[model samples]
Target: MRCLIAEDHLLSRRVLKELLSPDFDCDIAVNGREAIDSFVLAHEAKRPYDVILMDIMMPEIDGMEALKSVRSLEKKMQIPSHLAVKVIMITALGDPHTVIKSFNECEADSFIVKPLTRHKLATELRKLNVLK
Candidate 1:
């Protein structure tokens, strides 16, 4: 699958890439704006990303905002229902309120904590049915 990773931290991005490389074709975005731009460009190119791993905190346009933007764009563009990309939010914050908000209000497909282990990531991917 084609995946996009939106993360500001270099080490986190690198670790995710290393962990998921065997299972997917991945693209990296340093910030939320770039993530949105890359997603749009990829979709326009007929190579839409299957999933996106988004970091909550970012320099330009936070992940939640970016998620809303992406959803809006998908609606505006009339993208097919089946072609909608899934977004999984990743962060170090473990606030229950934020997690609840992310699930109910932000409409994230899933949430993953930072400093992830390969086993945990794999399990999460399996839960999403993104892993074989």
Candidate 2:
């Protein structure tokens, strides 16, 4: 599977890539803007990502905005929600409002808290059916 790790923190990106590299051919984006650009380019190249691990607080565009834009692009391309690229919203925030918004408003396939571990990553990926 192909996955995009969209995060601003170098350590966080490194850790996530290390964890996912076994199962995923991973791409890194330093911020939401790069994430969105990569998403579009991949689509245009006919090799869209299978999943995106997006950090909510990012420079340039922010994950929430990028999420919305990505969904819109999927819709424009006639990709149904079920067939759209899965998004696992990654965040340091644990507040109810943000979590709720990430699910209800942003329409993330899953959410994982920061200080991420192999266990947490596997559980969410399994739920999304991206991992066994």
Candidate 3:
């Protein structure tokens, strides 16, 4: 699978890539704008990302905004709902409001708490059927 990791923190990005690299061909974006551009580029290349791990707080644009924009792009392209990119919000904030916004408002496929572990990520992916 192809995956995009959008995060501002270098260590976090590194750790996530290390964890996911074994199972996926991964791309890294330092911020949300880069993430958006990468997503569009991949789509235009006819190889859309299967999953995106987006950090909620990032420069240029926040993850939430990027998520909304990505969803809009998918809709514009008329991609079927089941085939649309699966976005898993990665955030430090686990408050109810943020959870609701990410899942309900933005339609994120799933979420991962900060200080993420391989086990947690794997569990979420399995729950979403991105992994067996």
lDDT of 3 by residue, 1-132 (tens): 999999999999999999999889999998889999999999999999999999999999999999998999999999999999999999999998999999888889998888799899999988877777
What is candidate 2's local distance difference test score?
0.92
In candidate 1, what are the lDDT values of residues 1-132, reduced to their tens digit? 999999999999999999889889999999999999998999889998888999999998999888888888998999875667878899988799878877777778889887788987787778777887
Error in Å for residue 132 of model 1 = 0.9
Q: lDDT per residue, candidate 2, 1-132, as tens digits?
A: 899999999999999999999999999999988999999998998889999999999999999999988898899999977789999999999789989999888888898887788999999999989898
**Higher-lDDT candidate of 1 and 3:** 3
TM-score against truth, every candidate: 0.93, 0.97, 0.97
Q: Candidate 2: where is the Cα deviation over 4 Å?
A: none
Of the candidates shown, which would achieve the greatest lDDT relative to the real structure? 3
lDDT of each: 0.87, 0.92, 0.93
Backbone clashes counted, model 2: 0
Ordered by TM-score, highest first, the candidates read 3, 2, 1
Candidate 2: Cα lDDT at 27:
94
Root-mean-square deviation of every model: 1.3, 0.8, 0.7
- Residue runs of model 3 more than 4 Å from their true location after superposition: none
